[model samples]
Target: MKRIVPLLFLLVAAASLPAEKTAWAFRTGINLTPGLVYNRVWDPGYNGSALTVMSLRQNGGFILGGGIEAGYNYTGFNLHFPLRAGLTVAGGDSLTLSANLDLMPGLILGIPASYFLFALEASMEAVWQVSPCLGISLSAGPRYTVSPGYGEAVSPLEFIDLTVGLAAVMGN
Candidate 1:
């Protein structure tokens, strides 16, 4: 009962947010990166993070959404839930360029232990509208992950992730 009440309230509130286009788009992508991941010690490794963003368009230049990403950071697996906002920079019939930011509060689970993770990512993309229902994008971003300690173990604050990836956007 305790869990259900807050969940219901959240659903109602999300449904009430204002949208201009009245149509929603879902963005899905993948990030392939060679960087550093640390738990007890830092190592050079490759981390691939899958991403999705569902955007609700507002009347002006902005759109809002939220989505989750679950992936492997070489040493461990993690889940990232990110809130997204996009701004249309230049738009036309075929091509559009936009800037976006994702604020993520994430959870890491696997190898060494589990800890809390947070990352702020900013990216820019050029989206080519293949059809009214489909588009493809290429994007890159730098993510700074906050590593707060769990239990008595103190985690370092030096998890910087750089990623470049391709995305597919599908909608009406």
Candidate 2:
């Protein structure tokens, strides 16, 4: 009777414990970024040039956390360090969706020159959990950057970036 009573108590205790929720995850991936440059600009008007810059990118992020990206620029290299915040918009056993914003400060290095870059980005992400520790993610975002132009003054550039990622999730 004592053994049965103790077993029952253990079962009750286990049942009373709250299930853990996923509050954190880490993602890493490769991204392709193609940016369009403006040749002339007026207030609320822009004459976009056909010039485009393509970059090969490597990125990492922490959920509700921070982000870092390194890119091989067409001429040299660039680094973006961003502060990020996000929330899960929806979720179930196998999938989740999120929206995130990032404030980034970075450096662009070119041959014999360098420039400071600042940007704001808004992104939407969808993740499919394949296992407890592995997930695949697709993210798309628009980024606006303020940086020095090639020959003129500081200018703003716009980009649409797409990323395919893999993540490790915990506390789910």
Candidate 3:
């Protein structure tokens, strides 16, 4: 199941790419993500906090891309690799707007052995392309986490996150 999820996301992104013009670009950004955390079975003691991430992406006409992200919060740190896909939903030259979808798989560190977690996130982003080489974006989404419980059962946690970021873009 762990391998299947990422493979499925990659296949979907790749299958959609050939119909587009194939303009390629790369982006690096810093984001501030604030979220509300919840658990279905028990209390986690804390509800939420702000997280900071550094992300890098390589895209093709904003249609599809892959990225790596690393971040930290009050609880610990995490690393993610995600695949993105979407379209230019609105706007014009020198300033365009795009809507995007991302699927991320990640790991969390700094917790006890039984607390080792795996996270899968899905997000929607609104990007304002300021120029051919710059953009600003805001995104919101949900993240689901699964981990081993004290006695080896599965523990599940969920989060709703909102993020704002500024990026430097390169390529066509």
Candidate 4:
């Protein structure tokens, strides 16, 4: 499953390349994501402060790409390598709005041991271009994860996350 995601992303990105001229830019983002986490069987907790480093791509005309994010959450940590695909829903000269979907197959290193966590998140971001190559973005999203509970039952974990991020973008 881990190996399949990257291969699938590459295939999609390659095949979806526009026949006409299109540009692709690499982005490195530093973000602070604060979220509210709720467990099905347990009580709700707000232990969701994370410092994330994400590397994503922005296609010039069509918004589609892949990304990997490594972050340190409150008591646990996660490495989310997802196919971060986005669509430019709205935009202006200084600001651009996008909606994104992330299909993440990642490692959830909870309290004791590491386990598999398949996560899905849908988000909307508004990017304010500080300069030609720099931007500040504000994003809010909801994430759902199918996680292993170790000794407890298997269920989905939910979170509503808000992020403030800065990005450095280059290329077409």
Instruction: Give candidates' CA RMSD values in order.
Output: 4.2, 16.2, 5.8, 4.2
Model 2, global lDDT: 0.51
Tens-place lDDT digits, model 4, residues 43-157: 4444444444344455553466565667665436776666667888887878888998878766776655566666787888777777776667777677766555532443345
How accurate locally is residue 97 in candidate 2, as Cα lDDT from 0 to 100? 85
Per-candidate local distance difference test: 0.67, 0.51, 0.53, 0.61
Scored against the true structure, residue 139 in model 4 reaches a CA lDDT of 74
Q: Where does model 1 exceed 4 Å of error?
A: 1-16, 36-45, 51-58, 110-113, 150-157
lDDT of 2 by residue, 46-130 (tens): 2121111111111222244454566654424666655566667877889878887777666665555566666677878787888
Sort the predicted structures by lDDT, highest score first: 1, 4, 3, 2
* Residues 1-172 of candidate 1: C-alpha lDDT, one tens digit per residue: 3443454344334533765556566778876665556443667666566655544343456756666677776436776777767788988988988888877776676446567767888888788999999989887777777656542365354566676768888876
A best-first ranking of the candidates according to their TM-score comes to: 1, 4, 3, 2
Model 3 CA deviation exceeding 4 Å by range: 1-20, 40-62, 110-131, 138-156
Candidate 3 structure quality by residue, lDDT tens digits, 25-138: 566666555554444543333333333332333244456666656676444666555566666656566555566666665555543442444555555555566666666656
User: How many clashes would you count in candidate 1?
Assistant: 0
lDDT (Cα) of model 3: 0.53
Q: Whose TM-score is higher: candidate 1's or candidate 4's?
A: 1
Measured with C-alpha atoms, the lDDT of residue 5 in candidate 2 is 40
Best of the candidates, TM-score: 1
**lDDT, residue 62, model 3:** 55
Q: Which residue pairs does candidate 2 place in steric collision? A: none
